[model samples]
Structure formats: C-alpha cells, structure tokens
Target: MTNAADRIAVSTWSLHRMMGTTYPHNLDTLEVGPVTEAYGPVNESLLDIPSAIANHGINRLEIVSFHIPTRDKVYLGELKSALAAVDVTLQTLLIDAGDISDPLTSDRDTRWIASWIETANELGAERARVIAGKQKPTRDALDLSVKKLTELADGNAGSAVRLTTENWFDLLAEPGHVNFILDKLDGRVGLNGDFGNWGGPTKYADLRAIFGRAETCHAKASFVDGTLDEADYAACIEAAEAAGYKGPYTLIFDANAPHEWDGIAAEKAFIEARIG
Candidate 1:
C-alpha cells in the first residue's frame, strides 16, 4: 500500500506567488537582496491553506514560518483545528531565515531560531527547519554553527518536534561541509535535503552524497519559461532513492501556473507516476 504519494507533502513556499501579503514577515526580508520582486502580493490566507493542500490529494504539509499571519495562541489553535478537521499532518515548520554563521549576530539569530522552534512545538509540527547559514563554509563559521545549532537542539529536547536544516545557502552548498556540520551535531539536528537549492553538472552526485542523511526532501523541479525539466526532476528522485532517502517528498512548485493549486497538483502527479 505504501508508495510515493504516501511519502509526499507540499510546501507553502511553492505557492509564494499566491499567498497574499497579509503576513508581516516578507519572504525577501531576510534574503541578501530583494528577490521576491517578481512575485505578486500575497492573495491567500493561512486559514485556507490546509484545505487547499488536502483538496490536491496531499495529506501532509510543511509551512514556511513567515507565512503565518500571527503567533497568537488563538490563531495557532485555529490552524491546528483546520488541519485536524481534514486529517492533514503538519509535517514540518520551516523557519526560513537565520544566519548562525555571523558571530556578531549569532546570539540574536539563535534566539530568534529558538523562538520559532517553540512555535513549531506549539503548532504540533513533527519537525522544524532552520537555514544553516549564509557565510562561506569556513572553520570559524562551521564552529559557530555547531555552537548555536547545538544550543537550539538542546532546548528542543523532550519536545515532540525535531530540529532540521537544509543543504541550503552558501555555507551548506557542498556535501563535505554539510556532512561536517551534521557529523559535528551527532544527530542533534536533521537535514531537509533540497533538490533546487543545489544545481550544476554535479548536482545529482551531490544530492546522492547528502540525501542519505536527509529526514525530508524539498523535491523542487527546475523550470525554464514555465516549463518543467523532466530529466532533471527524475534524476533528483533517483539520486534521493539511491541514497536510501525514504522521507516525504515535500513538493516545492516555483513555476508559473495560472493557478497555484494546478501547479502543485501537476508536480504531485509527476512524482507519483514516476515512483508508482
């Protein structure tokens, strides 16, 4: 009975173009530069997102922390109730922006990340993701990541949610450094291996190397002028499976579709057909 559909989840970031700008935290707020210039203002509310995912045949979801309009307990309860009503699992709470690499801001950023982890616990997410870093993978930066991530992980002990990081940002672009940080953490943190974050000729090789340690995957497909690259998409799946990655394929649809839901459904079908 188990198949790829059972292992699929959807990320709200995929529908960033449609998720209206009601929430205070902008997706581009933490980026190095203004990158969301092309996307339209948010058009959807968090209250409506859960049912939307369920309607698409996906029962699991990974929500970007910023997309949440409020941290009030009442709102959080509402979101939880909505998901429970439809039997959807809040798989992961993605804490999108934080740079534990900068010593000057490490204290402040780590505290911020810890705050999100607490929210993830309150929201009943199974796991939470924090960005690894934006700095180069230097010894000092890696050491700083170890210290801050350990602190954040230790705080989550005895909580239902586990902490995770992606093979994302400049510091974690390579598998060697990715392993270095994970090995140093010694299972304290998990990985959210992202297919689109890493690219180039060696992308597949890199994915295979790091995905074995992945607790989940950001199964993103590359697009050119709104067209999906089927070859690369399949290869990313193959590499992940080859490395024994058996976690949920968190579909991240970033292409141009008339309706965000249609783009998400198309991705789910693509994955199901290949893995079925």
Candidate 2:
C-alpha cells in the first residue's frame, strides 16, 4: 500500500480538454487551470485560474507555457500576484519549443530558453518541463542536449527550479533509453513521465521502470471506442506506486469532449481510490 504522502495529483490540462474549454470560471470553481493560449501577446489569466480551481477544491496548478508569454516578466509578475492572492501553488510549467533535438544550436533559442528559466525562477516554480528538442541526425545530438541542459541547470542552480526533459520520440520508450539519459546526465536532470504518450503496449512497463526517476508526471487517458477504461488507468497508477514514486501527478486530458471534466473527475477518483 502507498502511504498518504504518496498521493497522486490531477493536472488541469486533463480537466480543460475534458470540459472542452480553457480557463474555466475560476480556481474557486475547478481547482485546476485550463490550458489556455497566451492572452493577446503578453498576459496570462493566472489570477483567474486559482479562483476557479479553488472553487473545485484544487489549489495546486500546473501552468503550461503555451498559455503564458514566455518573454515578458512584468506580465508574468501580474499573473503571479493573482495566484498568490488566492494561495495558488505553481506546480509545473511546460515549455514547448521547436525541435529540442535539432543539432544546429541557435543563439536565439538559447537566449529564449534562458529567459524561460528566469521566468520560472521568478514565479517560484519547482520545475520546468521541456521537450527533448528536435531529433538529431546523429547520436552526437544526445551529448549536445546533455551539455545544453547542464548549462540550463547550472544557471538555475540557485533557484528552486530543475530542468525536466520529456521523451518525444522513442527516447524514453523503454527503460534502457530512460536510464541512458539519466546516467549520462548524472542526476542533473529527470523525467517528466507522460502516461498516455508512449506509442505501444510497453507503456505500463516503461512507467514502472522510470517512476523512481520521475520528478513530475502527466496523467493522460483515452476513450477506446467511446468508453473510458479504468483497468488500463489502474495499471498505470499501480506501476507508479510499485516503483516507490511519491510526487505530484498531474492529469492531462487530451481528448475532445464537451463534458470531459466529468470524465476527468471520475479518473481522478479512480486513481485516488487505488492509492488508498
């Protein structure tokens, strides 16, 4: 049995897609932040999210970078203040940059990423979720990523933030690749495990292998022929716990449905029940 300290967390992205809406009423209504697009070009509705989530009994929030203007700190500060007013905690911030695996490193990309790290620090975020970049033409790309990530980590060393690189291709498709990256990085980085993204039947097994190294997780569920399967989800949760992982688990619902929030709540209940 898992201890109470090992409770799973539900990401608002799952609820956002489930509800078919972004930025639900307020944190007071949904305890989760709907994955929203950046408002105009600079602002994010951070204050509004916590209230909606608070209403729904959710105080923890994982803000996706796609929703916030990564270049502007002043606007970010405003958003941060709004969250602080409602006692909302920023759990994880995801940044989706173009081709993380691209071999040709750009000074512009590096600068943009540096800005992101700074913004994450200002918001007091615990971790930043980054794509594995673009897939490279040669194996040397892995070494390049390690060097770049190490640099990012070094810059943020004084802050609370840690860089978590997520698996895009089959890089993390198996335990070997997962361990390979961890071993090469030497604990300087960690994995952001996304349950539904794995391409094949090995999803459950892969989760089991990497759970111990997960700093944060993305909980994604699917509807097979219009029905939600609890058994598949139960297996994912079981794997997470069995590996002795105790951290925040965010639910990311990617399906498109009008009343998807109901499904998300159900999944959360199902996982929480098993955790008990």
Candidate 3:
C-alpha cells in the first residue's frame, strides 16, 4: 500500500508565504519583473524549493507558472537538474493564466497557453494543468474550450508532458459542464479535480461525479479560525476515493494556518487515514 508520504504532492502556492518572490511574467498584467513583498523578502530562489520540500518527505512538486522567475533555458535546465538531484518529481506545471473561451482573446490566449505547455515539457514535468475557461458557462464557451483544449492536447502529443484541466474558474463550475467538456474532449485532455473549487451542499456529490475521471487532485481542505476543518477535508477525500480516484493528492495550503508545512502534514495524515 502507498503511504501518506508517497501519495503526497506539494504546490509551490502552498508555500507562497515563504517563497518570498513572484515572477510577474505569467501574471495577468504580463509584467516581467520580480516582486518581493514585505512579508517574504527575496530570501530564497525557486531552485531551492525542491530540496526544501524534499526535506518534508514529499517529492512531488507542482509549480504555478507565476512562481517561475524566467523561461530562460539555462534556468529551466538548472531547475530540472535540481529536481533530479533531490530525486524529486515535477508533478505538474500549473499554467495559471489565459481564457480560451473568450472570442476576443481566444486565439492569443491559446498561443500563450501553448508556450507554457512547451515550458512544462522543457522542465521535464509530468503534466501541464491549464485553465479551461473563466467565462460564464455558456454553450459557446464550452464548445470553444473543447476545441482549444483538444488542439492543445494534440499539440502536446509528441511532448513528454501531459495536459489536464481543472474544476476551477467559471467554465467548469458544476458537474454537468465538467462532464460535457470532458466528454467532448474524448480523453484527449485529463482532469485535475480540485476539492475546494466547488461548494454548496452538492460539493461532495459534484466531486464524486467527476473525480472518477481525475488523473490528479488538489486535496484542498477548508479552515476556520486558522484551524483545519477536519470534517470537510475528510469528506472531500472520502468522496474522491469513493469515485475511484487513486492519484497523488497535491496538498494545497492557501490559508495562513499556524504553519504551511503543519497544514500540509494535517492534510497528508487525513488522506493517509482515508486511503493511503
């Protein structure tokens, strides 16, 4: 049986509080400079994150595109080398930008997203998680997302990295839209199901409805008063497991809990107790 440590993955976003820097190149504004905040001075390089997380007994790392300092080949090569040094895996390159569902920007954004997918391949990541769409859920939006995403899948056919869309933004807000787009893609694009993206009483059912198709998961748990909401987190993992999901659970620690790794440990333990 896989242990909690083996099944665990960490998103760089989880450690944003400590990462201390942001590469604005991938942000919506397209600014190309580094931004260091007061909370986290520019103390660490992105290259150092692998060995840092590896020290936590977690080797699977998912990087948000925005966190990358540059697309320079030398830098990317160094990053890949760093991962190999620590025996860590680049679980996914999260292309956290673009909206292919909008008519005005569809073509441009499709090209932009494709470039990030190429970056994913260069860094030797196993997957590239792209945003499907953020436009209101309309039939036209879904159709555009399907066409553009299928094209992306085809474009990545010969590359080392795979493609996955998330249950995030507006396009995949519900199970019906999620299934419709996935059905239309016909297995060309994969799913990166997120636990906290969908809410309401139907959250668990919605997770069960689509997690069966998930290739990976964002095991995000809710927190109240800086405390881990154990019941909510347990139910989310239970729902995913019930739907036959047996993939790496990427721990997403967004809220400023007592400690980032502490929050991650709590999540890892819950998943281990549930299905690890």
Question: What does the lDDT come to for candidate 3?
Answer: 0.88
lDDT of the candidates, in the order given: 0.84, 0.64, 0.88
Q: Please, what are the lDDT tens digits per residue for candidate 2 over residues 144-237?
A: 6666777777877867788887756643455776677778888887788777877467778878888888877776667665456777877887
Using Cα atoms with residue i matched to residue i, what is each candidate's TM-score against the true structure?
0.92, 0.81, 0.95
Report backbone clashes per prediction: 5, 31, 0
Ten-residue segment with the worst summed lDDT in candidate 3? Answer: 24-33
Q: How accurate is candidate 2 locally (lDDT)?
A: 0.64
Best by TM-score: 3
What is candidate 1's lDDT per residue for 1-276, written digit by digit as tens? Answer: 278778989998887777754343433233223224335665666778888888878999899876776777898899999989998999999987778898877887888788888889989999999987889899999999998999998889999899999898888999999999999999999999999998898999999999999999999887766667789999999999899888889898877653667667767888888777
Segments of candidate 2 deviating more than 4 angstroms: 1-12, 15-46, 69-71, 136-138
Candidate 1 is scored at a TM of: 0.92
> lDDT tens digits, residues 37-67, model 3?
6357754578999999899889899999988
Q: Scored by Cα lDDT, where does model 1 land?
A: 0.84
Give the distance in Å from residue 185's predicted Cα in candidate 1 to where it truly belongs. 0.8
